[model samples]
Target: MATLAAECDRFKIDVIGISEVRWNGTGEFTNQKGGVLMYSGMPDEQDPHIRGVAVYVRKNVKHSILCWKAISERIIVVRFRAKKFNMSLVQCYAPTEDSPLDQKEVFYSALERTLSEIPRTDVIILMSDFNAEITQSIELGSLFPHKTCHKVTWKSPAGNFESQIDHICISKRWSKVLCDVRNKRSADIDSDHYLVVAELKFNIPKHRYEHPQHTRRTYNTTKLNVGAVKNEMIERINNVSLMEDASIEETWLHIKTNLEEICKDTLGYRKNEQKEWLSANSWELIAQRRSLSRQIKKAVKSDKRNYYVELSMKAQAASEKGDMKELFKLTKQLGGISFQSSAPIENENGQLVFAKNEQAEVWKRHFEKTLNIIHNESGELTIPRHLNPNRQIDTRAPSVNEIRGVIISMKSGKAP
Candidate 1:
């Protein structure tokens, strides 16, 4: 997934649809590089992993996503908020023509229902493996003139036959925005199908309203451990001037300002430090492979193949030597998979809340309802005179010596 995302980034593509995901279940997650991958697969645990569909949107495009639905393993739809009219993308994995008629009917019936649910004003883009060849349709067909090689999307195992099974169809109302559609054969992902790319001449407008992001400044508090720094801070605080007849609030404001100024001058902000794990040699190999990937000649393909073999060997060697850190890093880089935090929580109406302020509001309402309970059956209890204690407890503040003893008994090197 990471490798595919990197390829999309290289081509400057904001969104891409994928078929045959084959992963179990349906959900969405963000990759380490910040790209969002929303996939739908077989919902049943007993079902075989097959015919899954997914859509990947780049980091910048993710903010515009309004909502998404996982209809089934072979169908998924994602809606995006756009400039004039919102855009809806439906990715599908249709059954082949040779499949049973009933199976094909089921797929088309579900697809029709999904399309009907979308608003008519939306500009829908239906894409991915349809497994059918049609010369005409309501959706705009590929009209750009290109070589036969650029039109073929899939090849037979023996490399004797080729076909264009994958396609990208846009609503006729907005068909003028589609500039061209072509197949890119140089993109090698160990699949018989080539990468189908579409060029659209349109702009995605900025969000309606953007919340200002406030970044909290973090000071290097460890500097306070230095004797000179500590002394300078204390001296600055002691030298602060205050009005003799100032109110309590005014005095507190003056002291707070002085303390903040002292801290800013003495302690600098902390910087985020990250380690570079890849060695120089690995980077060189990666660069060479990337350069070779752009060419479709036989010699370049052989060189790229050799590079993959070498990288695989290096990974095996690292595993044998028990260098788990390097092994894990290599695996993430080569296997095209990375870890993500988790999915966002849904609101009361089952809609996802992405903004921090909205999420806080949801939590606030939850706590208010949960913690404030009204009692329906309540009565005052009477105390029994026979159960009362015989001795009277003293109700006096502790003396200075007792307070000192209590403080001394507490453990050291801990926060109060």
Candidate 2:
């Protein structure tokens, strides 16, 4: 298991799943690089030996365990948290020739029921050693033939033939594959059966709290008639009989190179379209949003004008009365009000009254509060009917837009 694990490590897999583990431990170990979020089955409290499935998460990834349940002697379901959303993972060790068919049916039924209860939206990855030979056949002589199933994951006692006993499967919602997927015999160490590893890149649902661990991706821009471009590429690939003669690597490499060339041409067409769009309307839209933002800023700045006016009056009166203490306080307050700058979050109400040097520690908090108030008092944030379920706002951005509308209505003659 350790040697096979090292082979897996070379692939830089985020998670490693083991079936028929016979351990109750969650499989968490600090030494595991990506923070192993492992869980093995021991559903029945009466049974002591784990005797089910287990997982190991790399120590680097942040995660939390949601739930773990053992459906049978071989099937286990484990749910865990990764960032904002919860993910469910199932590992099954189905009964083979040794175990009765009745047991397999019972276990599969329970497994099916357990899986059905889970909603389709959740990110799920189901894998296991389903000892049964999975057939790719359908009813009758099927016109739409199923892809041939390759069976060579488990080795026989004589070490001559390997059967497709070990397996990994996934749900339709989280359906992602790493191009070619097949059984790898190089990972067989001591566990009698060769470990089945498949490289899958899943597309998770877009959520506010969830973020990608991978680097930022740049999308390939499409041509003016994008659908036509895609069809053309498909046609070009079909023209070549590369698959029949060339190695899989060579065939895929040729396809990728052609794809890049086609995408590059499409990108050129896209750039021209963007230029035309800007020429037609984007400049005006940019000016409009900016103008509204400017109007909002101006209204906020004027509020501080009154504060400055009051402070000036106080300073003048104190100077005339020979009260240096009052004059200094007034001057400092006025000076504080004079200096303002942009911070992490843009201020909604232009009034960022700089605190005096003595009050520097509270500058950001005080300014933020003032900005929120200004935003609340003004009507700046509005969502149009066409833009329902808008993209998420930056956490640092002021969100008092909704409240500001109410404040404005009340301040104007419209309050009921």
- Measured by lDDT, the strongest candidate is 1
- What are the RMSD figures for all models against the true structure? 36.3, 32.3
The whole-model lDDT of each prediction reads 0.82, 0.59
Query: Mind giving the per-residue lDDT tens digits that candidate 1 earns over 1-416?
Result: 75687678888889999999998899897876678999999998678988899999988778889999999998999999887888999999999978999999999999999999999999899997998754321222458888878987888997756777899998998999899999877674567899999998767764343553455778899999999998998898889998799999999998888878888899887775544455678657766765675653677669878877877888999999988877776776677544443345688898977657888898888877666444445644333444444656677988999989988998654465
Query: Candidate 1 at residue 403, lDDT?
Result: 88
Q: Per-residue error at 253 for model 2, in Å? A: 63
C-alpha-based local distance difference test score of model 2 = 0.59
